[model samples]
Target: MPTTAFSAHYSRELDVEQLGWLLSGDRPGDDQATVADLSQWAGWIRTDIRCSSCGKTGAQVVRPSKARGSQAVLRQAHFRFVDHQGGDGHHPFCEFYGNDTGEARQTDSLLNFGSEKSAETRAVRLLVCKGIETGLFNQATIRAMRQWFFDMKSESRFKVRATPEALAWARSLQRHPSYRRWTFHPAQAEMPAFDWQAAAKFQFTEENLALVELAKTVVHQDAEWKRAGLMAAKHFGQEVFNTAALQPYYEDTLTLCAFVAKNSGISFGKTSPDYYRFQGAPIPLLALCALMLFTSEWEMNTAIAKFARLLASAEPSDLSLGNMIGLNPFHDYAAWRLVILAAEVAERSLKGFDYQAQLTAIESDLRRQHAIWKSAG
Candidate 1:
């Protein structure tokens, strides 16, 4: 499928289903998270991620982007959305200006970013910096790194965060040893900054882990995922089936992202996996379900129904964790996809990663930027 079509479908799915879920407040208490808390949580997730990519154990990534200026808010995002439109006319979902086609003037708010820190940019910047620091990463590598971090944190949506220095630091880390693990490729000559103990300090708990498991399974199932494909059969499949590979990766690195984030307690980005899934409640259960359905290769239909029943049992009379699988606006599939790729890189560089899917999502999201869209066209 073309990128536009995939995004259109994703948007349509969210507009119709996910929107109702968000508005209806139908998710399990597990997904319940306050944006107020998300900042600090995101900081922690970054800390763990920092350790993994930068090889820095003694000095955790400093969260310098916490206090932001007023002009850096989401107002400019409005213009970005406008630019995304490219005057190509709005899709069926757009209704903000009360019109679909015809050029719309940029609103004052459109010229600004929301006071909210861009979690997506800041978080991804940390990962992106890993790219820059490690050797000369190509633009595609940068894209992959950025896309991966965003997916790991947001699942698939975008997160906004931190300040200018936050972005700069993220750039710096990529240059360190961490960015080399962008996709679990062949072999990395770069040594990690932290020893094993430090790696264990930070980790992803809650929903972040839940989503990582899902994304891992996704990477496993995808034939396009070269190294992971081999590893998946050996680890995700046989290990789960016979050898028991699921928890090792999570224990050593993924969970480290969480533990590190929790201990570091920095607030530079939007929604770090640390912040959102800081605890071990709702996200874990969701992850368990995802594993059963996606990885175990068990009865998927039964798994879907099981999760559906779990969602049904939750409050609001109607909600399912599955609904947000790839559509949550707060960084859904796209972010987690990166996490999966990064995990692969942690062990070794892989010629695998589903970037095409991610690019499609980003291109579509860019359209939502409006301003970027107009400029692109």
Candidate 2:
């Protein structure tokens, strides 16, 4: 089952955590709620929520509440699909299919970072180069790539030595003549030693700290907005931040921002210099390489689609070059900045690689996968 559901009322997807916040009577702009308001919103969700992917109704929003037992226990809110007469199920090719089935898993030993000649590796390298050149690379894309890698690792049929092999293979890719230009350069500033395992750790501590610092500067003008900012930071700290897993917290973060805006009447339109300062922080080369090597066309396309929606919904002023370079109020500003930095590094490193052949190979593979899925369906 998916952790997120599409809300027809809002015309956007929301995770169960966000729904839980709403159930507590927290509206998009206000934290305060009355019993009547809570009941009303809960009814709204029951009517409007549906499958994010297939748009199928019969999706239910489960709120966090105490269990009816001698020792009462609290449960976390989540989304689930329910069956009833004539109700539609998920689409045949939806990613949710086979997710919880007891199907045989692929063996890790059988899953290798194939040689340079392999189509998957070439496709990944080419896509990264193209993304940087086209100015489309961002945090969501990076997250998608990482998610693909972790999905593979998690689906291994048998336990195998993965980390050591993955690290060595990634290092070899980084050292290749075509990739070396981007991974290492004499004129570039000193970088941390290449460590795939270490780089995989999502160190949001610095970003969260920077966000809190930004919030502090705004306290003089809007105390409620400041509170919302701090609350968002705290929420980030409380949630598990893993580069390798699906990012449900991103929705949670956005929901918190929406709450502050709707409840407190604070406009996040004006650009803040402090937000821009933190955007300039450096992302590691090895991490970028890891992202490129594991990313699939499907994952990249999904990420790009979501990013496109964010851009389409943003205000014209929010799309200014300076605002785009740093954080803006449109989406997850901190995450967006990270993507920008990553793209810069990627573009500089992939300056001279030939991309045409890789593109051809990728398109061919995509067509083949689509055909197979179609036949299966």
**Candidate 1 residue-wise lDDT at 104:** 29
Number of the predicted model whose TM-score against the real structure is largest:
2
Flag regions of model 1 displaced more than 4 Å: 1-74, 77-113, 118-127, 136-138, 144-256, 263-265, 268-275, 278-330, 333-377
Which lDDT tens digits does candidate 1 get at residues 214-237?
333432222223322332332331
Cand. 1 Cα-lDDT: 0.27
Model 1: what TM-score? 0.21
- The per-residue C-alpha lDDT of model 2 at residue 309 equals 37
- Give candidate 1's root-mean-square deviation (CA, Å): 26.8
Ten-residue stretch with the least lDDT total in model 2: 319-328
Of candidate 1, the 10-residue stretch with the lowest lDDT total is: 1-10
Looking at model 1, residue 109 earns an lDDT score of: 11
Candidate 2 C-alpha lDDT tens digits along 165-217: 22222222222233111221222222445432222111221212332232222
